[model samples]
Target: FRGRRGDTVKILWADADGLCLFTKRLEEGQFIWPAVRDGKVSITRSQLAMLLDKLDWRQPKTSSRNSLTML
Candidate 1:
């Protein structure tokens, strides 16, 4: 998500032993990062999880029953 248009994503990790680098490329489509941030470099783990689930992590979900109104 280095502000480039592509499917490949690079991940860098460092542990006590050594550094690890990982990459994931989708066959189609692209992973989108938000453009509304004031100044942010990376997202939290929870945010990443929500993105992976195709949900908006920054907000709460509301449930409403339309059947009751119909009744």
Candidate 2:
């Protein structure tokens, strides 16, 4: 995943007999990221898919209105 400033992320995994590396970058826009904290965060499969598509995984739909109203 790339940060807001275009920082790229590299993922490494070990297979049966060797290691593999994968990377992805968006030509435009940034991946939706969780709040910065001490530990790691978890995301659902659908969220991951949305992220890969360069969409905001945090929100289900971009045009949806906020349910909360200001008093």
Candidate 3:
């Protein structure tokens, strides 16, 4: 999905209603593409959410702090 359609992405999957198609386009910059396998690209539901948020869905990062306690 490059060139004139670089900003757009399409997701196809099967659900209870049978087949479904989702299309989205970013206002600026193109969506980061995932690796393709056998001519197809795939990602998890969580990854999809991260992708939509303009985060690196391939390996999303989160900040964490270790708890300091004395028992």
Candidate 4:
């Protein structure tokens, strides 16, 4: 992740047709990050939403809706 606040980066991937890019940026704060295990980070859907919103994902105000995980 970018160290500086408001620094944006694009993720590039290739699909069946062609290359695709997705970009996400935080206007004010750093994204809430999850602990990495075995060089990978896994978080719940709710955590992702909170992270995207620049909120603290470690302790959510509401309970998690699903036990499923995301990377």
Candidate 5:
């Protein structure tokens, strides 16, 4: 996991064949993280998608009520 000071982190996971490494970094800003006293925290699918897109995943925007009806 990355630190609050814009540190780079590399995570290794066990795959079916071998180990897989995933790296993440921010060029301009730091990644939004959850405030938890525990060592680990769970993130939602939407949060993960936002993180991958280099967005702040902490505060997710709610969907608008307006919708288009399909004919």
Candidate 6:
């Protein structure tokens, strides 16, 4: 999130005894920030995946695949 359009994103992380940094850039669509509070917020692994795909994080699960396979 340190770069602009067509640029690169710089992500810095720190753990127990090590520090890591990474970068990524999207070819289209602006980055969509998730809801936040006064302080930083975190999401679960499944929530993160939905956010990256720009889908509703709170969507209910359906069994459409089960019906389709039965047809």
> What lDDT would each prediction earn against the true structure?
0.62, 0.66, 0.73, 0.65, 0.68, 0.59
State the lDDT of candidate 1 residue by residue for 1-71, as single tens digits.
Answer: 44266456666788999988876666667665555466655688977765555456668375675335633
Count of clashes, each model: 0, 0, 0, 0, 0, 0
Best by TM-score: 3
Model 1 local distance difference test score: 0.62
Model 2 residue 66 distance off true place after TM-score fit, in angstroms: 23
Between candidates 3 and 5, the lDDT winner: 3
Q: What is the Cα-based TM-score of model 6?
A: 0.47
The window of 10 residues in a row where model 6 has the poorest summed lDDT is: 1-10
Candidate 3 is scored at a TM of 0.65
lDDT of 2 by residue, 1-71 (tens): 34447534455669899988878776666667656556665667887677667777777785547566678
Residue 59 of model 5: what lDDT? 62
Error of 3 at 21 (Å): 1.9
Q: What is the lDDT of candidate 5?
A: 0.68
| Residue range 1-71, candidate 6, lDDT tens digits | 43445234455679999989876666765444445667555668777565555556777366666664433
Clashing pairs in 4: none
lDDT of 3 by residue, 1-71 (tens): 32355688767769788988777888888877777789776678888787767788867676656556678
Q: Tell me the TM-score of each prediction against the true structure.
A: 0.56, 0.56, 0.65, 0.53, 0.62, 0.47
> Which portions of model 6 show Cα errors greater than 4 Å?
1-11, 14-17, 53-71
User: What are the root-mean-square deviations of the candidates from the true structure over C-alphas?
Assistant: 6.4, 8.0, 3.7, 8.1, 3.2, 4.7
Give the poorly placed runs of model 5, Cα more than 4 Å off: 7-9, 62-68
- Ordering by lDDT: 3, 5, 2, 4, 1, 6
* TM-score-superior candidate, 2 or 6: 2
